[model samples]
Target: MKKNKMSFETSFWTGLAEGNPFREVDAFFAFAYLDYYKQNLSEMVIYSRKTKVYKQDNPSDVFVLYTAFNFFLKVCYGLQKKSKKWKVKDSLCCETVFHLTSLTQEEYENPFIVFQKAFGENTLEEFELFLCQIVELSLSPHAGDPDAELTTPYIHLIKMLDAGELIRERGVEKIRKTDQMDPVA
Candidate 1:
């Protein structure tokens, strides 16, 4: 008899409500919002940019998710520097350095894993889930202009995305039409 290994979705995240977007992990995980969540990616992006739109949210432990996924290779040092430059807190800087040293200098860990363990992020799975939350906020009509959206995390995610440092590090060859409007660009 073969026993199946439980996934984080079925494990770490439990007691999901019916019709929850997370039930279709691919929607967020594979960027298949259209198929799974009935969401249009471009619309979501557009919705996210409208920072003034307000949303009425019901109280619930679970928050919906949508994500713009990007990660840099071997970026722990950059995280460290960010802490020093006051882009992030000092504790986060120390944590980044700690993970950098312990994961790379000592264990020779994989670059991808190292970034996940660094100060600002969690394990790869948790981080991916976090990205989904970003996507969720971007899709809401309430996400109109600043201080409008019902969700909070997406606001921070938008600010981070606006920074474009990661996008720059990823070395994008083509900028999206939506991105052309970036204040920094």
Candidate 2:
């Protein structure tokens, strides 16, 4: 007999829908999307004398950004089909912090569990740190282009997390609090 421990997806999305993307187990994915959802990485970088949004600095940023994008796309796809199972395009999939990244399908119908196993490496701390690094980098004045699609939300989420203000919690409590309250009418 096996017992099921709550998964990062459940925990992360619970916090996200509630408004907190920086919760304990969900911080990594939260931070990952902190920048990813801001813009599409599939586009090539345009150089400008004014700012270096995609200046050739390190490859890791691209890696994490793509990973974040994949995560988002997977979720969106899952919801559209009413199934959490999703198939990631190979170009956007990544397995580790040291690889070129690859695409893959959710083997267990559980995206977060697969994500945890693929990148978690059984280290929540590492995931948290990775998230922090992405968040800090995203905050840089010269990080991604301010006009880029991903910049605004990414920055906004980072600001909220850095301030230690957890987003609204999504769960029975929220429903209970909302429904149990008297109507204004």
Q: RMSD per prediction, one decimal?
A: 18.1, 16.7
Model 2 misses residue 59 by how many Å? 2.1
**Regions more than 4 Å wrong, model 1:** 1-120, 123-129, 144-185
Model 2 quality (TM-score): 0.26
Cα lDDT tens digits, model 1, 1-185, are 99543322422233332232222222223332222322333334454566532133431221333222322111222333332222211121223443332233422222222232343443344444444543555545554445433243333233232222322222223213443565765
Q: Estimate each model's TM-score.
A: 0.23, 0.26
**True lDDT of residue 159, candidate 1:** 26
Best by TM-score: 2
lDDT top scorer: 2
> What local lDDT does model 2 show for residue 148?
42
lDDT of each: 0.32, 0.33
CA shift of 92, model 2, Å: 36
lDDT of 2 by residue, 1-185 (tens): 89533322433333433222223324434464423433423222222112344425764565555444334433322222322332222323434532312213333122233433323232334433434444434434354444444333333223322221111121111112235678789
